[model samples]
Target: MKDYPQSVRRKDRQETDTSFLHEILDNAVSCSIAIEKEGYPLIHVAFYHFDAANNDIIFHFSKHGHAGDEITDGKKASISIYKYGRLYTAAKAVDFGCEYQSVIIYGTIRIIEGEQERMQAMSDFFDRYFAHIPDSSYEAFTAAQSKPIHVAKLRIEQWFGKEHALPAIATDAFFPAFPSVMQPREA
Candidate 1:
């Protein structure tokens, strides 16, 4: 890898801190994956887990969808995860904005193959979303009855992270309670 790609328009908002990227991923439960098939563009929204240990984006999808067969290694893919923060309103309509933390990863998608790895990924997914279940129940279900699902991992080649925070100086004067002007305001 490369770091940030040339695609992000707002260069000033780009963040390089590894922890910031992890933070965004940690807080997000869903992501939007973009792929191309048959010379057309496609995007899929799915639940995901960010495996920081190996820097992988893990997710499961139905085995019958277009993704099940197309999302294989050596294929280009991109995933975007975001956290919504407070809305940022400016006195000027053109300056209206919002606070957020987001990460976009561009990489190759790999469908996990081995049973053991698939099981481990399943366990991680279960633990992440249903940690309250009794350990015995969880283990038995995963170890014995869990059928193989289509789990895919994206090997990140380049990533981008950006965040928006309201400046401390931002006050009521900057963000009005109502719309700026009923008419156009110069930028």
Candidate 2:
């Protein structure tokens, strides 16, 4: 890992364990990439595969989309993956809190060039999301190989992880019930 500056304000919540950080990266449902387009910032969320061996992330987007036009080789970007849990209610509004785990990575994007490398990255992506299914059971991967997509890798240079877990069950402030949904309002 590169020696990047640490600027986390809350040292108590700062997570420095490598294994825990990697776990978040591997299991998070989606990641958000922040990039600059035409001097303006843009964020794109997508499913990604965390390449632990290479210390990078692999993802793809439509070749015809705005992301395809904005992202380029050697472009610097920031990627963030996060998961949130139940809300903690408190009598004081300022005391309200929510459980969360997050990992932020700073890196440069590399548009994959070689056909073999691109194919391998896509295969790895498919496997990450569909590990429970047998490889022979689905033809979607095979079919998607011919699609017009740009498979790119985010080479991580620096990363930081932080988490705030819910208080113990003994704490009455933590809401243990399932979250209720809001009903649509009629005009």
Give the range where candidate 1 is weakest over 10 consecutive residues by summed lDDT. Answer: 168-177
lDDT tens digits by residue: candidate 2, 1-187: 2454575788878888989889999788789999877777878888999999999898888888789888889888889899887788666666678888999888999999888888888888877787799768866655355468888899988888989886554234445565445856557
Q: What is the C-alpha lDDT of each candidate?
A: 0.78, 0.82
lDDT of 2 at 120: 87
Residue by residue across 1-187, what tens digits does model 1's lDDT show?
Answer: 3444745788778887889999888877899998867787678888898889888999988677687667666778889998865556566666766677899999888888788998888878878888887877633555445554678899777898988777444443333345445877659
- The reply for model 2, stretches above 4 Å from the true place, is 1-5, 167-187
| Each prediction's RMSD to truth | 8.0, 4.0
Which parts of model 1 are misplaced by more than 4 Å? Answer: 1-7, 136-148, 167-187
> Pairs clashing in candidate 1?
none
What are the clash counts of all predictions, listed in order? 0, 0
